[model samples]
Target: MLSLSGLALFAGIASAYVVSNGTTCYLYPESQIHLGRNVDDTPSIHQAFDQCGTNGTVVFTEETFHLNTVVNTTGLLNCLVELKGELLFSTNVPYWLSHSISVGLQNQSTAWLFGGTNVTFLGQGGSINGNGQTWYDENQNHSNQPGRPITITFSNSTNLWIENLRIIQQQFWATFVTYSHNVTMKDVYVNGTSNSRWNTVNTDGSDTWNSRDILMENWTVVTGDDCIAAKGNTTNLHVKNVTCYGGAGMTIGSVGQYPNSPDYDENIVFEQVRTIDTFNGAYIKTWQGETAGVSSNGDAGGGGSGLIRNITFKDFDMINCSLPLQITQCIYTEDAGACETSKSRYIEDIHFENITATSRYNIAASL
Candidate 1:
């Protein structure tokens, strides 16, 4: 278990709230709170949040809490969440698909929507299990399956700290921070894979969108999609000391999706990354041209403009990874002639430094 007690030393420097001397509220499995082994704990959790929203700490003790309903803990102010137990989301795919909160960006939905100012989530070697095997199987067979909910999302929030969490089997992206600033995620583990037959798809480890002044470090991710991805309108981001296995590598954009929307990502840096048996490492991908309708992943968009600048990837060690370095201006398009004629986004002032890798495929760099 990673202890966050050391964070107290740097709390002042980092501008993070430390509840060392604050009120402590413990949440339990109680019938009165509608929290039990089988009962939904969403209400109880919210009640705790209400009680300990400011200058306090909420602790989830070592027990299994079943969440059959969506829990939105947005607008939390100066609180600490200590997770020392398993937080399991129910496998009722249809129920969640219909009931989850619509996040309104790229058709994303979430089971847990956490927002607001100066919030900290410290998982004391605990797990947030999404129970995603059913969703993966359903998507494999049903071509028109409903959008699966994201495991956890932080949106429209600021000054957040998330550390030492074991997040597994996410139905969609594991941790998504968007439209926020001054966030830090460290010592986090994310895994979405199958030992049996079903395959997880689009289980990105962490995604940042329209956010700035973010830092992600000391992460271990084994997923089907990008380990860490920076999407449009992101700036002043830094990522380091991340180990990725069986996923798409660290990426910027799949941007330029919404037509006429100006996207910008700048001053981003990824350093000290280690990749094993992954797809791509240190990549930048963008869409091209104006055309769309029910695109891949049941989404639709095109002809968005963007500017990517002052980005750097350094100190990467790739072992048996495919496409160690890739920069593509044309993605999700088949018409070569159209791509040639389309007005693509601007990409400039990019740097790749101290990258050492062994490619599983024969190709080294793709541009």
Candidate 2:
């Protein structure tokens, strides 16, 4: 078993020495490679990955790299991605819409896909810029354009580590981990806001789906959506030492959608979490039974079943949070009478311990 402390030490050492040791491929600013202002560096970035993917490191030094096209780093192995520079995705909505990879999850797509086994992304205080202002404005105006792409995605991966990264201005969910296992995300920061007059929607910090054995710690997240959300088929998940501001707080599910498909989430834990100006502190939400046409994205719903068990939320503090603790079987529906009439998923062995909270509203717990 790899210890967290040992992983941290290795990350520190790798960030410092990998470039100098010739195991690193430095992304140099070359005119031919399109490495400067208004230039698309996608080809050069792919070249670096091809040259130094396995058993090596790809280092982005303290400069700006622009990406107008999608970069797919799937199936990478035994590699470290050191981002000490700004990775700015293009704000050109039409180009991204035509180029991004559509994963078909509630209209979620990604500008970049980072996956495969034994990969480490050490940001070292670097930033991943999504340049989401244009997307926000476009969505506010059109509302039917191709959905904005997520910042980063880990799909079908194992033994992944992401640390010390600042993800900014996400178009959609900041980071998404799906169909993966043995993942650790520590000391990460995410910030997103509406640059236009409209409010940004669905900018979750990080969300896990169909994954297991994940650990997230020491995160500072400010978004318009959930700080961290576990969606479906997630088990043995642990989250700790997280601070959330101006978002919906830590959440388990808006699960039980997609009828005839069964989902389960078990052995989840959240500890040492703090929330300020957040909407809710700890939440578990599920869609009521046999519902259809219930998604904001106009996706069909219903025919999903699930069991959420052995969930724990402990050592949490909330200030000015609207709903400190909320557990509801009905989500996306305001009709309590209809909810009571419908069948919902089962939730068992749920525990909350040592929670200190003050709600902006007089109500503290909504269950």
Candidate 3:
């Protein structure tokens, strides 16, 4: 979290609705009249970004903004976003299914594609609500829905600072960072609990893929999926002071999916974390080699090569966790002997230190 005083990008650019301060420009959306309506704020947001997205600030001042369309605001330069309001997505299943932006990762899509250089976002108690109960009830079997958008995505960007942001009931993963670098998020909260009979599936708190130099701390995640997952080509990720509930704690991979593409993840660390009623405090799951298929849950993978190296999970407090630490190389494979016989992904220099876990099972870990 960076203060406005610390912003050093002094270049000035102003427009009709954009105002200029000492070194920072500001744009307050003029569409406050459309608050809480069926009207979309995506165009207003795009206008503000186009006007004051470079060396400036965009202030979301309304109490609530209803969005029913896709939002893609990227390539901003040295901007700060002040969120003093809520951004709520509509539950039009058919509309979103056709309009969500493709992320090019395992049939995933996103409601918003947000990224930029030197972008700093400070959410002053504001939130992004996905209104996921609709999706949950629609997809009753919890199967993967094509074009079900993640709440937000940071992609193809650099130098992002996001703080004090809350995401509730995301349609899919709360946040996904891909092909980005030098991203930091702190004091973030995520909740994806379902109030209906249908479960909230695939609602990962945060996931990173093809990214580097990421730092996440002081996050509280309540979801049905991974709290934080590092997918293929993730490097130098350090997550600390995280508290997870009812999720797959901290995870590395389900990688090694593409047979031709090599998965390389290295220098990952998750320290001082707390998991309650989670599947595992920390785990690494890689697909078995010489195999390819999709699972019942619609996760398609297998037959890939890779190396996971220099990973550490330290100082974890796991309460009633199934496995404190797990390394499964044969995930998604039915053959028990295939884990040993198959040419699987390689793991080296892995360490689990100072773990205090009370597993429901007798075995503390499985490797």
Q: Name the regions of candidate 2 deviating beyond 4 angstroms.
A: 1-23, 29-36, 141-146, 335-338, 341-344
For model 2, residues 1-367, the per-residue Cα lDDT tens digits are 8799778655544433222345677774333233334777677778777767888889887777778889898888899998998888888888888778886566668889889899999997579999877777777733224557888999989999998989999877899999999999999999887757976677789999999999999999988779999998899999999999888899998788766666799999999999999999999988767676744434556546889999999999999999999998767666566477336578899999999999998899987
CA lDDT of each prediction against the hidden true structure? 0.82, 0.82, 0.85
- What order do candidates take by TM-score, descending? 3, 1, 2
Residues 34-132 of candidate 3 have per-residue lDDT tens digits of 343366667767877886788888887645777778998899999999888789899999999999999988888999999999999899878899998
lDDT of candidate 1 over 109-202, digit per residue (tens): 8889998899999998678999878777777723224557889989988899988989988888898898899999999999888665766678
| Residue 66 lDDT in candidate 2 | 77
Model 2 clash pairs are: 259-302, 259-303, 259-304, 260-303
Give the CA lDDT, 0 to 100, for residue 265 in model 2: 90
